[model samples]
Target: MSDDLEILLTNDDGIRSTGIRALYDALSEHANVTVVAPASDRSACGRSISHAVDVHEHDLGYAVEGTPADCVVAGLAELGPFPDLVVAGCNEGANLGEYVLGRSGTISAAVEAAFFDVPAIATSLYVPADDETPYYEFDVTTDDFAEAARVTTFLAEHALDAGVFDHAAYLNVNVPLPDGDPAPIEITRPSKRYEMDAERNGDAVHLTDRVWESMDPESLPDPEGTDRRAVVEGRISVSPLTAPHATNHHEILEELAAAYRSQ
Candidate 1:
């Protein structure tokens, strides 16, 4: 809990989102937090980058008219102080399943930081959705982010010194609305369940994620030790993951190379 720690805070939900503000306030108490986030809500924008973006000076920090990845690049390269860690989100929605990893702006921001060799933590809240009222439509307040802020602040204070980064590039964290006791933290992995439905109309194809229908305790298809299940049961899910994808050499490719040389 060193007050001297430098943290670069960014999020996919824009600078004014309650989630980011809650996180900024929480992290500010423990470290030097510089909020370099998008100027508008850029949810699910993934790792999209901009060639050039406008920047504005805000009371919290700098706001960029670009994607979350751009905010991170700008913060690290030009704007804020060089940081010890990058914390993205307290995101409006959960970035839970493996399918969402490449398509979540919150997670992408953390992945970008990981590529820079800086450890990061991307936090999101698992807001359950029903047939009538979705989580997005709920009047989510700053208080809703309190637990996420607490979890993130604790990680920021201790993770680096504890050598957690040696085992992981970044951590993708998902928390649910608080229940009786504080939610238990579980080391988990992104669930592999992917359910997409595409219905063709006259000239349009409406796509839906069928997985949302199963978010309830009775319907969740994911098992224990998975992100979705942890959150569904009111537990905090933390997936310690690597940044770059892995690759391996194979004899088939080597043989092809040898044959090409003969030609």
Candidate 2:
């Protein structure tokens, strides 16, 4: 790592989002931060990248007409001053649970950076509600992000120095909304629970996902060490994870090979 720390900041909430701006302001104090985020909201876009993108210079940073993954890739590979670390979000909503890891653009950006062998962190705030409504709107301005941003900036500055990424590629962080004091941070794993249901209404079928509605702190089935549990308990959740898909036993392949040899 260089003395002058270089950080590539991005998010799924677009360049205009308050989360990204707050992150940039908080990180600028410690590192050389550059923002290259989506031009429009690309929430839950996962790791999908645009085939061709248009990049333009904005007041804050480069605004790319693509997904969060595309911005990170283009920034490190093509853009100048290759960053040593990638930081995605201060996202408006939390990206928790195993099922959400593959569907969250915030986490996906970090996963994309990890593929390039760069250490990354994805940070989000868990809004306490039953629906997708933001507890803090985009236009609302305040220093409410101080707690989340402080911890994120601290990790961004020292996580590499502490050899935190030696065993992991990226970290998924979900910070609970500030409640007068900073909460304890917990190292957790993604919970595999999912709440998705569909309803048939005449000709149109309503696809309803009740992940938020069902996320009651009192009724959660997650264990003490899980990400969902940490967030539910009002603690900051940090889940260290790898980007590469793990290889498992292939019984079908073994049977096919044996059959071919016998024939």
Q: What is the TM-score of each candidate against the true structure?
A: 0.96, 0.92
| Tens-digit lDDT track of model 1 for 37-147 | 999999999999999999999999999999999999999998969899999998988898999999999999999998889899999998888899988998888888989
Please report the candidate that would top lDDT against the real structure.
Answer: 1
RMSD of each: 1.4, 2.3
Go through the candidates in order and give each one's C-alpha lDDT: 0.93, 0.87
Model 1 CA deviation exceeding 4 Å by range: 252-263
What lDDT tens digits, residue by residue, belong to model 2 across residues 131-200?
5564544343446566679789888888998999998899999988788887899999998778888999
| Model 2 lDDT, full chain set | 0.87
Clash number for every model? Answer: 0, 0
Model 1 poorest 10 in a row by lDDT:
176-185
Candidate 1: the clashing residue pairs are: none
For model 1 the TM-score comes to: 0.96
